[model samples]
Target: MLNSVNRKVFLLYPNLIGYARAALLLLSVFAFHVGLLRFAVGSYAVSQLLDAVDGEVARRLGQCSEFGAALDMIIDRVSTIALYFAIAAKSARAGLLIFLLLLGDVGGHWLFMYTELKLGESHHKNSAHLPPGLKHPTSEAMHQKLMIGGNP
Candidate 1:
């Protein structure tokens, strides 16, 4: 059964929002590339706002799913890294810093996701199984304190 793909989650309101976010993110990057900073910023800001809105929309609409959550996560990281690339493109001096930051950003999130998948976490955001230090900065681990049901 092609469960994850067959659920028609691609049409869920939250997932649709995710698609919009992805499109807006691409628009932001392209706008930045084409020397449209204001447009890029506006698009990026809306995407970020939709990031927060998607979860709430999912919760309220009873539309939350692994697919939507995963979509949210993937886009969040991709957009952030894209912004870092934009910054690196502009600041010749901070290229190395951006490189290191993104390296850690991507690496840490990857490790955390790998761990979550190995443990069969239905929700990849859970992190109770990991060591204290392994909680990734870019992942929900940073919000452990603010999140309900997180390890105390």
Candidate 2:
């Protein structure tokens, strides 16, 4: 009989996927700097797709961790901010909207996450601390709807 044990490493599969996504993000930034706009946009697009893949991989491999989740969230915020900044740089007229969008998207999400932490609830789940008159929908589903403008 042979016995096998699973040993977790700092560079787990899901985390590796995250690292790759981060690399792609960096590549996109470099491409943009070098005026390769098409390549930059394409790389950024792939990196966004990898973000979802990492979460799915974590779930399937039972490798989810607090560090991974937090890292993912941080990366998401940074990427969003960077993208918005790039868009805003194109014209002054669009800058105001980008600023408002950044405030709403980044600031709002941070506040929501902070509230969930303080209330001792999983950030994605409904909990007793939910504000009055608000329906208790899972954060995951709400996020999906908000992101894609459709049902999760």
Candidate 3:
């Protein structure tokens, strides 16, 4: 069933796992809306935990594909956005933090992916292959400088 061209794409194990995570995230949003705090937190945590394993499952099973990667990325970003939006709805302090986080996450990932594609590099390679002129730096050096507040 796994190899047959007639087999449904949704039936693939990795894709099925991704769909389950998405469902959990959706439930998390609904739970948060209904003020079921424990349920919301648990669902969201499980979704994220699944995220860490889905890629490995795909790689080990030889199921990796551009479509799978795109699906994973979209689900991850949407989940993060939904989770933070829900938190922001509950607390003003969380709203401020969420605003900053969403801005950096959405904007930074946009630039990062754009540059990665433009440079003909895979997303797995990190920013080490990035050219010097790029503004969105994710290198360890850049992070160290930011952490130290210095020109290193």
Candidate 4:
């Protein structure tokens, strides 16, 4: 087996998927730019689905790496921001709300990742510093609060 440090993680299946996601997002943005709404939505949706698969593929193939994690997050943030900006262009009033939400999304991710690096964490998802109840998004309490029709 190859040592972790020497592995060609960029070529790993998960990272390959990440690259594909980046390409798809690029296409998505271009499509949106040219007003090809169907193509934009289709590429973006497929990219999002691939994002869900990459991490699981990484775990199953023993290919998870910090680089892949960062790539995934970067692509995800870009996708979200691009979509938000497109939507924000519709109306000034609602655009402000969308922009604020986009700000929170980007700011929160940056803060979380920055803190992780500052604290020398091995994984971006490390939330041990948080209380047990809030350590995970899938936790029962969070699920109930976040699920559709559950609560605001």
Best by lDDT: 1
- RMSD to the hidden true structure, all candidates: 5.8, 6.1, 7.6, 5.2
Candidate 2: regions farther than 4 A off: 1-9, 125-152
Query: Tens digit of lDDT per residue, candidate 2, span 37-65?
Result: 99999998888877766776777788877
Local error of candidate 3 at residue 57 (angstroms): 0.6
lDDT of every model, 2 decimals? 0.77, 0.72, 0.71, 0.75
TM-score of 3: 0.72
Candidate 3 lDDT over residue span 74-134, tens digit each: 8878987996798788787786789899998778877877887888765532456756554
Note the residue pairs that clash in candidate 4.
none
- Write candidate 4's Cα lDDT for 41-132 as tens digits: 89987887777667667877888788898888888888888878878765667877897888899999889889988888766544667665
RMSD of 2: 6.1
Q: Stretches of candidate 1 above 4 Å error?
A: 1-7, 124-152
Cα lDDT of model 1 by residue, 1-152, tens digit: 66776768889999999999999999999999999999999998788777766776787788888788778878978987988998888889998899898898889877877777888865554467756675434334325434532222
Positional deviation of residue 24's Cα in model 3 after best superposition, in angstroms: 0.2
**Full ranking by lDDT:** 1, 4, 2, 3
TM-score of each: 0.76, 0.74, 0.72, 0.76
In terms of lDDT, model 1 sits at 0.77
